[model samples]
Structures are given as structure tokens and as C-alpha cells.
Target: MALAEPFEIARGVQTESETVIVELTHEGMTGVGAAAPSAHYGETTATVEAVLPRLFEVLPEDPHEIDAAHTAMDRVVNDNPAAKAAVDIAMHDLVAKLHNLPLYRYLGLDATETPTSSFTVGLAETGEMARKAEAAVEAGYEILKVKLGTDRDVEIIETLAETVPDARLRVDANEAWTPKEAIRTCRALDGLVEFVEQPVPAEHPTGMARVTEQSPLPIAADESLVAPADVPAVAEIADVANVKLMKCGGIRPAIATFHAARAHGLETMLGCMIESNASIAAGVQLAPLLDYADLDGSLLLADGADPFDGPPVPALDPTGVVGTGARRN
Candidate 1:
């Protein structure tokens, strides 16, 4: 899928995202999902494609046996979470459709009070980012997630804050700062931003804990919190846990991770890769369970670039929908 423009984050830049569509058919009903792999998590389109057939072989005969399916897939192979997520999402879509209910209804989630998603402002020249942010606000977005990590991170954020004073702002550093640098930057951004995300590397837990201990604003753990087992450690260092379907396998694991985060007393968030509506729609169904949402992956794609259509975003309304609402456009 082509992006509307180059999307630069602290880690790198991409002009297009490569995604693989996965489809499952059961009792004359077809459910669709897509894999938007992330190399940072050790998976790519090729890796997902390579492992999917094997994973498919282990799928339970019944869609409702999702936990069993996950165990079977894990036994067959180690990582390759994006591949597993594709299958898991398709199963959820299929099961919900079979029951004539929306995915949220099947999972028993309430959509009445879901938080609106935040539109991301990927790293760019300071002025260009500001222009994009202002344009997003004009286009009807009330919250923005700005990518930071540049030497001018402060300047870029300050510019956007001034440019759109009324817009809610959140900054993600994507593990770019040193412990000292993170603390200093977080203090500088205190009231100007909502929270700082993954300021130090996930491998450096001690560094993250130090930054979290000293930072003035809340700290969100993205890379630091990958699965349920990591929740305890993450809760000790961060105030918020950012869960991604691609990172933790899929909907089932995401749910488990969210519950674990809550059990450990960390605020929960759901984020996504630059994905298609095929998978993003599934994320939207889980919105009511989140304290924050960064589900603008599909919205970042160039118009008509996505091959599938799903739920509405920003608004994240799952009203009166059957299945996961992901179908070929």
C-alpha cells in the first residue's frame, strides 16, 4: 500500500507498506485479514508468507477454539507473530460472522465509550510536519500523535503545539533517546504533550525505568511491552502499555496483554502498524477496551490504495456491523 507521502519515524522512513491479505472460508462465509509485518519485530512479508501455510495446518477445526489454535501455532514455530495475527483475526471475523454479530459483540466489548484514535504526524522537516498537523486538524482530527527523535524534537513539538493549540498531542520517540536525554526531553514536554512513548531502547529496561522515574509526564511502553509476561516489568517502568496486534500475535493475545496490563495497574493503549482496513477494522472493534488508541494506520494510506474496506476510524464506530467489517473494496 502506498502512503499519501513519505512517512518518517525515529527509526526510519517508508514510502509504501507491504501487506499480505489472508482469507478464510467457513460455512459459505468468508472472513478477511491482512498482515502488515514489521521488521523491527523480526517479521516481514516474506517471513509471514513463509510461515502461514504451516500455521494454517495447525488451526483448530472450530473457530471458537482460538486459544487452542494459538497454542498449536506456537508449538509449530517460534515468532512470526504477524503471520499468526492474520490467521487469528480472520478466525475472529469468521466466528463473529457465523454468530451474526459484530466482532466486538462476539468478544463482549462495549463500544459506547471508546476513545477516538489519534492521527500520527510522522517525522519530517519541522515546518512540513507543522503544516501536515494543521491540515489534519482542519480535516477534522482533534488529537495528533507526533513522531519525535530528531535533534529538533523539542522544536518540532513546540511548533505543532503552537500551531494547533487546541489539538491534543502525544509524542512517540520510538526508542531514540538516552536515559538522561529522555528525562530532559520529557520534562521539557511536560504539560505540552500527553505522554512520551518508548524513549529508550526496549533492550535497556534499566534506562527506561530511570527515565520513567524522573519524567514529569506519563511514560508509555511500546517496544518494552510485547506480551503478557512483560507486563509486570513494564508496569514498574511505565504508566501506559501500548499493545499492537502485529507485535503480540493477534486479537486473542492482545486481549490477554490488555488484561495483564490492567492487572498490573498500567493504562492500556492499542496501536498499529501502517496496515490495511482488513486488519485495522479488527483493532477498531477492540477500541472500547483502550484508554488511548493510535489506529490511524489505514488512514495514513493514499486514498484508494487499500484493497479492503472496514470500520470507520477516528470515530471508531462499530455500530450495527456484522463480522469484522473487512471486505474487498
Candidate 2:
């Protein structure tokens, strides 16, 4: 899918997202999912496609046997979370449809307290980003996640704070800053932004801990926390656990990660890659479990670019839709 515009982060810029859509059929019903693989995570369209067939072979005949399916897939392969995520998501959609319940209701999550998702403003010139922030506010987004990595990160954010005074702001550096730089920037923007995300590289755990210790704003772990096993270390240094379906596998593993985060006393969040509603919809179903959300992947896509339709974003209310509410347009 083409982005509405170029979406830049610290790692680089993307103009289009190549996503693989997955469809699973059983007993005359079909469930849909998609894989929005990220090269940063060692996945691409080819990787996801290559691993899916082997993963599918392990899926249990019963869609309800999600645990067994996951176990079998893990035993078959090591770190193909995006591929596993597609199958995992499809199976979840199928099970919910068979039971005639919305995905969240099937999982027993309350819909009353779902958090509003943050619309992201990818990196751009200071003036351009400010314009985007103003447009997002005009479009009814009260919260915004501003991408920051440039040398003028502080200037960009300060301009945005002025551009949309009422908007709640969150900033993601996407592991762009050095430890000292992260700490300095975080302190500089303390009151202007909500929190800072992945300010330093994931490879430097000690540096991340140092930044976390010094930053005035709460820290959110994105690249630093990829799986449940990383939760304990993340909890020691970050205030929020940013869980993504692509990063941790899918709904089942994401749930496990969230539970582990909670047990370690960290705030839980759900983020997404630039994705279609096919996968983002599944993430929407789990919104009640989140303290914060950044599930604006479909919103960033060019209008009508996605082939599937799913739950509404920003509001992210999943009250009455059956299954994942994701299907072909």
C-alpha cells in the first residue's frame, strides 16, 4: 500500500508498504489476516511468504487449538514472528467467527475502556510536520505520535506543540539517539510531549538503561522489547511495554507479552507497522488490554489503497463486529 505521503522514521523512510494478505477457510467461512513485515526485524514480503507454508502445516484441524498450533509452529521454526503472526491472526479470526462473537468478546476483554489510538506524524521538515499535526487535529485526532530523529528534533516538536496546542503528543525516536542525546532531548521536551520511545539503540541495553534513568519523561520500550523474555529487562528500564503483533508473533503471544509486562509492573501499549486493516483489525480487538495505543497503520495508507476493511481506528471501538471485522473490500 502507498502511504498518504512519505513516512520517515529514524531508521529511514518508506513510501509504500508491501504487505502479504492471508486468508484461511474452514467449513464455508473465511478469516483474513496480513503480514506487514519490517526489514528492521529481519522480515520482508519474501521471508513471510517463504515461512508461511511450513507454519500452516502445523496448524491444528481445530481453530480452537491455538495453543497447540503455536507450539507446533515454534518447534518447526525459530524467529519468523511475522509469518507466524499471519497464521495466528487468521486462526483467531476463524475461531471468533465460529463462536459468532467479536474477537475481543471471545477473548473476554471489556470494550468500555479502550484507549484512543494515536495518529502518527512521520518525520519531515519542521514546517511540514507542523502542517501535518494541524491536519491531524482537524481530522479529529486528539493524540499524535510525532516521529523524531533529525538533528532538529527538539525544534520540530516545539513547533508542533505550538501548531496543535490541544493535541496530546507522543514522540518516537525509533532508536535514533545516543544515550546522552536521548537524555538531553527527553529532558528538553519533558512537558511538551507525553513520553519518549526507543530513544537509543536496542543493541545497547546498558545505554538504554542509562537514558531511562535520566530522562524526565517516561520511556517506552519498542525495539528493546521484542518478546516475553525481554519483558523483565525492559521493566527494569522502561515505563511502557510497546507490544506489536508483528514483533511478538500474534494475538496469543501478544497477550502473553502483555501479561508478563503487567506482572513486571510496566504499562502496556499496542503498536503496529504500516499495515492494512486485515492485521490492524486484529490488533484493534485487543485494545481493551492496552493503556496506550498507536494502531494507526491503515490511517497512514493512501485512501482506498488497502484491499480489506476492518474496525474503525482512532476511536477503535470493537463492540459489535463479529470475528475481526476484516474482509476484502
Candidate 3:
């Protein structure tokens, strides 16, 4: 049986979390895993609840058979993203445990290297944004992802650029701007921001194409991409694609989307849905192949039990284990 547990986080905004837990019982051995959905993607408590019952029906008894797991996931996709992610991660965890392999190893990810993760500075006033950026920099995050798209977008970018002048910076609008505004904003912040994500709505790719063609900084699509089906359009308009397991509905689709993005000459980023370590761990399996990463959702949680959190926040080692490196200052 698998269950979803909800947690609350105080980040750029106060948000509720619903993480799914999968329980596998075979020959008296049990294993557990978790998944979380993105609220920005229209996932909610009720959405997760609606899909749980159906997911349990086809749950596989064996973890080694990726085919069976894929079939189950295909069925679960009928549900919302949160539900699908919960089910998919739980199954992956079970299979990895059954095989006595780390989840990342099971997925064939480079385990001995720790990829640099971008710490996000959520939407705030210019001064506050600068302070947050400074704090993240002081904490040793080499990359800083800023949340923009609000009315104060320009001021926020300028403040961050000044505060963490040397840090690699990326911005995510969460689809908060119109095409014209996106062009104006990206051009305005060109030198300061490394890239801007999903400035316009996902439904209007042509508009984004226009913005991408005219903008100074590169653009990455976040909400605008769902499955491999949407990748072609996004590739045409955006320079990068942000792949979230929750948004892609699960790892299967996320991998497919990754390959699709690569084939289209677009950069790839592994993004998270403000999730816990369980979900982040699943994402970590695919991190080695990504050009950019935003899997720091676990860092934003005020209270949560994460196996990855050691004496100091562990840097991802090449082996994909959490504790393989010296703690960063």
C-alpha cells in the first residue's frame, strides 16, 4: 500500500505539501519511497486522492521488470501530476531495494559525481531579494535561481545582480508575463541574468518563439512543457527545457522528455516540485545528464526528515551517494 503525506513549507510563499509514500511487502521485506506534485501545475490534495485507489490496483510485485512498471505508470498518468509522481517514485524505490542497488545506480546515473544545484531566492522586494541572494551565496551555493515575473521583476534582478555579481543566476517567471512583457523584461535584464524561464504562458509557444528570437538572454521552458509531445514546440521557441518529474507525470516521461530536448538542441535542467528528499533523490538519478539543476526543494523545507541531510548539507558525490564529499563552507 502507498500513502501520500502532506507537509507545509514556508518559502517564497507558504505552501502545503502532499508527498506520496509507497510501501512494498515481499517475502517479509518492506521498502518505502515518496513523491510530491507542484501546486503551480494545478495539483491539489483532492487531485492526489482521486488517483491513489486506481494506482494501487496495478502496482507491480516485482521491481526488476521495468516493462511492468512502465505499464502501470502509463495507466496512472490519467491522474494529476502529484498522484502520478507519487506512484512512479514509489515503484522505482521498491525495485531498487529489491535489487539491492541505490536508486541512482538502478537508473544508471553517474553515482560518483555531485552536480551543482541552484538555490532559489523567491519573490521579494529588491532589498530583501538581495539579502536572500547574499545569504545563499554565503551558504556556498554556486548558482542562484531567482523567482521573477511579478511587477518588481526589474528591480529584483538588478538587486540580485549587485548582491551576487559573480554567482551564476537564472530566473523563473512561472508563466507570469505576456510575450511583449517577456521580451522587454529579458532584454532589460540580459547582462545580469544568465537565462529566463517560461516568461509567457505555455499555451502560446509562438509568442514565446518571438520573445526568444528577440530577447538577449536565453530562455528555458518550465510550465510550458509537459510530456515529450510538447517538447518539439518548446524546442522551437526556447533554448532550454525544465523537466520536473511531477510535471512530466513520472520518470518514464521525464527521461523521454530529456532525450527529446537533447535531440532538439535545447539544454536540459532537472527541476523539482518543492518536494522532499524522496522525490529529489529520484530526480538525482537523472542529474548527471542535465545542463542545469534546481533540485534544492529539500533545502527550503523548515522541518523535514531527509536522509541526504548530513552534518553539513552534503554535496552530491560522483557515486550519487549523499556523503561522498567534504562539506562546502
By summed lDDT, the worst window of 10 consecutive residues in model 2 runs over 310-319
lDDT-superior candidate, 2 or 3: 2
The list of candidate 2 runs beyond 4 A from truth reads: none
- lDDT (10s digit) by residue, model 1, range 1-329: 89999999988999999998899888998878789999999999999999999999999988889899999999998988889999999999999999999999999988889999999999989999999999999988999999999999999889999999999999999999999999999999988999999999999999999998999999999999877789999999899999999999999999999999999999999999999999999999999899999999999999999999878778888767888888788
lDDT of 3 by residue, 80-195 (tens): 76676666666666666666666667777764555578888777667977987898889898798888867888888877787788898888887788899999999899888789
The TM-score, computed over Cα atoms with residue i paired to residue i, of candidate 1 is 0.99
Query: Candidate 3 has which clashing residue pairs, if any?
Result: 111-318, 111-319, 111-320, 112-317, 112-318, 112-319, 113-317, 113-318, 113-319, 114-316
lDDT of 2: 0.93
Model 1 spans with C-alpha error above 4 angstroms = none
Tell me which residue pairs clash in candidate 1: none
Off by over 4 Å in 3: 1-12, 111-114, 304-314, 318-329
Against the true structure, what is each candidate's TM-score?
Answer: 0.99, 0.99, 0.86
lDDT, candidate 2, at 112: 91
Task: Quote the RMSD, in angstroms, for model 1.
Answer: 0.8
